[model samples]
Target: MIKKEWILQKALEQFNERGYSEVGVRELARMLEISPGNLSYHFSKKEDILIALLEQFSARNSSFYEHYLTLSPTNAHFLELMEKIFNSQYEYRGVYIGNQYVRTELQSQDRFDYQSIATKRASTFQKIFQGLDAAGQLRVNGEDIAFLVAHITLFGRFWISEATLFTKFPDKNKTIRHYLFLLAKQLSLFATEQGKKSIEEFSRGMS
Candidate 1:
């Protein structure tokens, strides 16, 4: 890997294993076996590395949203999408779980407009639900759609933090399945009969 990519990879690993506050740029240089000055050439502050990592995370989520837009919407398909979402959250657990520290450090940076990001995410969820409603998989009205979107956006953003508390060992697949169940259950409340059936089949397949 090139030096910049190498630095991000090592930094992500250390950040995920140890909380972001505990890791420093000098320690990252030591881990990369490079001089501190060289590391600074790529990322001057630890927050710079954090911003890069968050960019990567945002890109991955955008790709997933784009891909799903092309697929036929179904309850099963939505569940599958949730699985991918949870997996990505697990992969970047450090960022999601240590969100307080992240927010504190990046609050004044102005590099990321978190409110805008949240707005876009809610818009995406609206599209997904609208698609499902057209597909006859979901029976949701405009008011309920707003409610569901709000809860879903909240849950998706912070589920990792909550999961880490109850999970001792944190097996990726198991943690994903647990959260998926809760998400699927929430959807079932607004799902059509066909949607319920699709979810049932999906749940059975997961077992």
Candidate 2:
């Protein structure tokens, strides 16, 4: 990998393993086995590296949504898409875990608008839910769909932080399964008979 890409990859690993506040540019340089000046050439500050990672995260999410849009809108496909999303969030979990620090650091930056990203995400979920409803898989009305979208978006964004608080040591697979089950349960609340069956099958497959 090129130096800049390599730095971002390793830096993500470090930030995920250790909280964002705990990892500095100097630590990242050491982890990458490069001089501070060399790392600085790519990212002058730690926040710059974080902004890059966030951008990558957003791009990956967009790719997931794009790919999912091409697939048939079945409950199974929806669950699969959600699994991919959860995994991506886990991969870049440091951002969620240390969101307070991240928000403060990037709040003033013009390059990254966290609120706009969140609004777009919620809108995407709303679209998917509407699709499912139209396909006769979900039995939700407009108002309920809006409420459900809010819950799902909020849950997806901050589940990592909740996991850290509730578990002494959160195992990735277990935490993912726990939250995923909750999500499936939420969908099952308004799912059609066929949709419920699909969710049950997906749950069994996970087990």
Candidate 3:
């Protein structure tokens, strides 16, 4: 039974790595070395598997962001957080962001947890911004800042996601990191010189 659960868990990972449209029941079962009927017993539809994937992803991300927020968020920490999120969501070859993009293209509501997943992530951003505001460390208003950071992060991820187009380049990893780092710098989008200096000061604590 536990093995079966592992099978399902891995399947979700694959679906997240791949997209719901690109993955199918037979392929998932093949990846797990199980028959289609057995896989169906666990997840009746591909959409059901996607829901599971998003649920697990949501829980993990929610917990991670909450814990980090408690640890005294600073600009450096925020930058790190942005980088991590980018790697998972918008990095080249990442399925999470890809699946999300595909889901948005699909009009069928039941196929994805579009709003719920997005909301959970946005709420985490809200919390972080609120914390910064309370600490008197934020130069920008929490509401507007949160909105900006969210879109900046997403856009950075979205931008770096096109690394595949540069496949002919010999230094793909180097190129990708260069772009990702540039995007990470957007963390300072709304900070004042004083606010920016304060953020720089926090870098000592980050390392």
Among the numbered candidates, top TM-score falls to 1
Question: Which 10 residues in a row give candidate 1 its minimum summed lDDT?
Answer: 90-99
lDDT of 3 by residue, 1-207 (tens): 536458656875674466456777898888888888888888887666656655555565566676677687565566656545545443223235444544554346565555666676667777777666666556567567667657765764455446544442235345545554564355456665655666565444433
Candidate 1 Cα misplacement greater than 4 A, ranges: 166-169
Q: Model 1: per-residue lDDT, tens digit, 172-199? A: 8888898899999999999999999999
lDDT of 3 at 21: 66
What is candidate 1's local distance difference test score?
0.84
Query: Could you tell me which residue pairs clash in candidate 1?
Result: none
lDDT values for all models = 0.84, 0.84, 0.59
What alpha-carbon RMSD in Å does predicted model 1 have with respect to the real structure?
A: 1.6
TM-score of each: 0.94, 0.93, 0.69
Where does candidate 2 clash, by residue pair?
A: none
1 versus 2: better TM-score goes to = 1
- Cα RMSD to the true fold for all candidates: 1.6, 1.7, 4.5
**Residue range 1-207, candidate 2, lDDT tens digits:** 347888888998887777788998887788788889999988999988888999999899899998988987778788888888888888888875246877777776777887788888888889999999888889889998999998987788788778877543588888889999999999999999988988988999889
Better of 2 and 3 by lDDT: 2
Q: Which pairs of residues collide in candidate 3?
A: none
Off by over 4 Å in 2: 166-169
lDDT over C-alpha atoms for residue 192 of model 2: 98
